[model samples]
Target: MTKSENTLIRLEAALERILAGEPKRIPKNRKLSIRAVEEEANLGNGSCHYYSEFSSKVRILKSKQRSSSSQQEADTGFTDFLKSKAANEKRIKEKYRSENVELKKTIQQLAAEHHLFNELIRRLKTQSKQLEVENKELNVALENTRDELTQLKRERIFKLNKK
Candidate 1:
């Protein structure tokens, strides 16, 4: 129809294309500004200010974009929270696994030490029994020798008295 109307249509189309490509590369909650739309449309400076309809259309588009972007930001924030939570859980599980492995090694080492100590105790008990037997035999021999000495002293006294 008119030249200005044709230019406005081009601006709208450019804005639509920019928004369409937003999910791939754009940051969260980003709305197109008048300057940005104008640049995409290849329009000269202050062209939007010159157009009364341009201002209203840009306002409506910005409002609609803002509402949708708010929802998108909320969804992205929730997704980020979930990812962080999962990562934290994974770290905790790994730490517990590492601690469990260390505990198992400690238990195994203690078991080995216990076995060694038990064998040492058994050997000591056997040695103690052998020593006890030897001590009893020595005590019996000493008693027999003491009795023989007493008998010899008695005989010596009796011969002296007779003389």
Candidate 2:
């Protein structure tokens, strides 16, 4: 009938969506906070604070939701609760087990790459040392060639002067 009424209805719907794990505007894993409700309802931030009554109602709903699962279990029976809990734990255990296997594969791949790189480095170092030795021997040969050329020039000059 009024703007306030419309906003309140929207907020209530958003809270229901969140509680039912079917939120539209906000993420499913978002906690039951005023801000989350506001976002879920597509309202501005702190909109809930504008209505004190609505804010209090939201708080109450949050507290109830926290213990709702246990309350449901109590209403039903311990057997059902235990079965559900065991199933949940089994799922979690399997998730972690698969993750561990993937991590071990990644580590093995990395180790193999490291070993290959180390071998490459060793071969490169050996080639580098061999090149250095060859370079030094070439330099010595160059110096010897220069000395012989200088002697030959001096002898030619002495013969020309005598002529």
Candidate 3:
């Protein structure tokens, strides 16, 4: 046989082996594809694309496999499990998203409250300093008044003794 004929034959055998899940050159249970077939046949990449008829056949076989597998999954109730799992995941994602939004609002409120408290503390400190200055002034004035009273009392006592 010609080299082209030999290549076509190898390609056909590879395609069958892959579809039957009995690949020799490649690992078993690999997904069916032109590249997989090429590897299974020990042929170079893009070898199968040169033959349009083979490419079409591969497409038809892959579609059939997909349909059959999907039907089997439905029969085994696996499709239902996957659907429920996906729904649960979606619900959990939405719950977390809403919680994240609430947490952000709480953080914003706390930040505002923190700013208010800091401002109040600053005002209190200023008032305390003013009060301290006023207290010191009052103490100095009271000491001067006591000294004047003592001098007046001494002058009165001396005047009475001389009389």
> Which candidate ranks first by TM-score, i.e. highest?
1
How many clashing pairs per prediction, in order?
Answer: 0, 0, 0
lDDT of candidate 2 over 1-163, digit per residue (tens): 9999999999989988998999998889877989999999999988889889989988987788768966886878887878899999999999999999999999999999999999999999999999999999999998998899999999999999999
Give stretches of model 3 more than 4 Å off: 1-76, 157-163
TM-score of each: 0.56, 0.45, 0.49
lDDT of 3 by residue, 1-163 (tens): 9998899999999888877778899999787888888998899999889899998998888888889988997877976888899999999999999999999999999999999999999999999999999989988988888888888899999999999
Task: Flag the better candidate by lDDT, 2 or 3.
Answer: 2
Q: Which candidate is the best by lDDT?
A: 2
Model 1: per-residue Cα lDDT over 19-80, one tens digit each: 78643233324567777777777887677877777778888878887888888998999999
Q: What value does the lDDT take at residue 103 in candidate 3?
A: 100
| Rank list by lDDT | 2, 3, 1
TM-score of 2: 0.45
Q: What's the C-alpha lDDT at position 80 in model 3?
A: 80
**Cα lDDT of all candidates, in order?**
0.82, 0.91, 0.90
